[model samples]
Target: MADELTTRSALQLRDLVAHGEVSAEEVARAHLERVAATDDQLKAFVTVTDDAALAHARDIDRRRAAEEPVGALAGVPLALKDVLCTKGVRTTCGSRILQTYRPPYDAGVVERLRDADVVVLGKANCDEFAMGSSCENSAFFPTRNPWDLDRVPGGSSGGSVAAVAGFQAPLGVGTDTGGSIRQPAALCGLVGVKPTYGAVSRYGLIAFASSLDQAGPIARSVTDAAHLLAAIAGPDPRDSTSIPKPLPDVLAGLDDGVSGLRIGVVAEFMAEGMSDGVRAMVEASVERLAGLGAEIVEVSLPHAGYGLAAYYLIAPSEASSNLSRYDGVRYGLRVDGATTEAMMAATREAGFGSEVKRRIMIGTYALSAGYYDAYYAQAQRVRTLIARDFAAAFETCDVLVGPTSPTVAFPLGELTADPLAMYANDVYAVPASLAGLPAMSLPVGLGEAGMPVGFQIMAPLLRDDLMLRAARALEAEVGFDAMPRGPNALAGAAI
Candidate 1:
């Protein structure tokens, strides 16, 4: 029953609960059992809320018994990336500094989830402060890919994607600063959406890069992601930057196929460095869309090569500023040393992992007096050029298409020694993020690594529904969810 329940989509489970085919308590219990049976190897969760989930499930059962109104997501169990706060839950952003820190209130998204009657499973693991492209930076433990445990699950949302793909949960939330969500979604073969900047409120998500950070959903299918987005998206007075637009009928838009729409296949994507397998898959995706009656247009974004360099500078600079509050004074782990100031320095030095410190130092240097103009300011201007490039490309087409990443999932330790190479992993994703465009990752097919390869679909800012509609069409046409290996293949392996 647990395996059967875990395999179902969140919408399917919701319907079952609503129709009394299964009770909320049973669904919640089944998820908890799956988590217990699998999480030790996956390390997908930073914390699991067994008690709170069951209690919420009981409350749902009681409400249903009284015939009270329940939200569409009533009793659906979902996991949140630890980057989002939850009241009293140890919302460690996979960093040692915040290992013991618990927030006093729920994040805006968490409140929305509660209102939707979704049960909180726990906080998923993430790269420290959402910095690394892989989950390896997590001070707790790395989240391995469910498909191949020895390989990485693209991150900083690795845990959330792994949790969903590993059948720990049906849906989860993830943030994309520079392809953090989409890259991982592509790697994990799940549908990951990074809505237009300001489309979803960032009130409770720990700041990564203020301008680039936006939260959305990660689920097994395009429809599931759309449903989760509908539940959490809307204006939140708490986040001043949040767009106050009315939610789109995302679920209703799922049936809109890719007929007579113009799809842009960015020429830069097919340039040198893209693996043959990835190119073949993306080309196949274009053919599939063409078969669906969509026109394929070749578009150029000349300055896209600068996206990675600009993103590293800007993201780290903002991270340096946002992380200044953690001086071991107000919150998080503190060190016991000679003096107050010394202890603060020691705490940070000892608590933060090597990668986190490296980025912070890089960011601090970029923002420092002499280097500010050359690094930070220059990066911002380059950002402007990239945005302009997107504007020009969008003029010719309704959506942009490309392989989500250059290659498929690699072994866990493959790129650890080369930080620049690891950062380059997001080459395809950072461009959309820098432009603040709405982009989603839909699995196209398996690549040479026997793991999923996702095709990224980018729509103009605030055109999230069109992006979803296009992705749903492609997803339906190229169904890639069929697992390559049996569950027993991963039986004793840690993901």
Candidate 2:
């Protein structure tokens, strides 16, 4: 029974805990054990809070026993990406610089999770300061894909996806600056949502491209993702960017199928450079959705081709500004020197990873005196064009669909030496981010090596429900199994 608990979905576990059929502590233990059993190989978590989780579970159990009202996700364990600040818990944004810094207050999303009675098992790993397409850039360690240990689990949100896919947790929260959440979900065979910007509050999230970063859910099923999203989606005074508009229940019309909905297939997303295996898988999913009564049409996003170049400039520029606070004087790793300036320089040189420094340099240059108009301003203009492209496409389509990642999970270290190759992974996933639209990656089928392929679904601004409805519809038809088969690291995890 304990081993079987790990296979259950978040909703299933929620029901079991809420009904008192199983104590919350028991469920927490089952997942903690799974993490202990597999984390050494997968490197999914930077810190495992077994003691904290068990205590949280006991509190939930006590509430249930006392017949007190509980939140929507009572006693469910979740893997929170380390980028979000958690009160008293070390919030290492997968970097050594802030490795020891613990926020005095919980992030807005963390507050929501606690209110929802979610148990956070640990701090999931990520690319340092959420800056890479692959998890290999983490200062602590790289997260290995559960599908094949030799391969990479897609970037910054890889740890969150790894936990759910490896059965270490049934739910997780990850941020998408570019495709951090959806890209990782694609490689790991899970459902990942990048909610429309402002749909979820960004307060207390360690800044990383503040304009683009959004916290969303990673789960094995569409409904599970909706439940998680609802718990954290709403206006918060703490986050000025949070939507002031009242949020509708995210799960209200979730299961309603996509019949009569027009799903636009982005032509730019299907262009050359997509692997044959991935192309075939996405093409087949479009056919299946058509059979399910969704109107399929090919739409062109001509400006989308420039999304990559613009994102690189905008994200890094914001990062350069946000990261300037880490200059030795503030809490975190500090290296002393004779002068304050020397100390700050030495500290940053020692604390930050190579990728972070690279981005900082790029961003600093783009924002420099002479280059501002030519680079950053131009990039912002390009961003506007990309948003216009999406707006034009949405006029005739209910939701846009395409391959999330150009290819299935690539082997670890294959593209590490060539950074440009890595940047290309987000080609299909970036335009939606640039447009501030609600987007998701749903497991469609296996591609090369029997690994998972994710079908991307995007909806108009503030119409997250529409995208989810389309995803649920196609998900019902494709029915991809998400169990990992990567050697003995987490083999038979679902069992």
Best by TM-score: 2
Clashes in predicted model 1: 0
Candidate 1, 314: how far from true, in Å?
0.3
Q: Can you write out model 2's per-residue Cα lDDT over 218-326, one digit (the tens) per residue?
A: 9999999999998999999889999998556668888888789888999988888788889999999999999998899999999999999999999999999999999
Top lDDT: which candidate number?
A: 2
Question: How accurate locally, in lDDT, is each candidate?
Answer: 0.88, 0.91
Per-residue alpha-carbon lDDT of candidate 1 for residues 1-495, written as tens digits (9 for 90 to 100): 544787788999999999998999999888888889888777899899999999999999999999998887998889899999899889899999999999998889899899999888989989999988889999989998888887888899999988888887889899999998998888888899999999888998989899999998999889888989999988998998888876666777677898989999999877877788888999999999999999999999998999999999999999988987788988998887789889889889988888888888999999998999999999999989999999998898999999899988888989989999999898999999999899999899988767788899999988889899999898889977634353422452112
Model 1: which residue pairs collide? none
The 10 consecutive residues of candidate 2 with the worst lDDT sum are 486-495
Q: Candidate 2: which stretches are off by over 4 Å?
A: 486-489
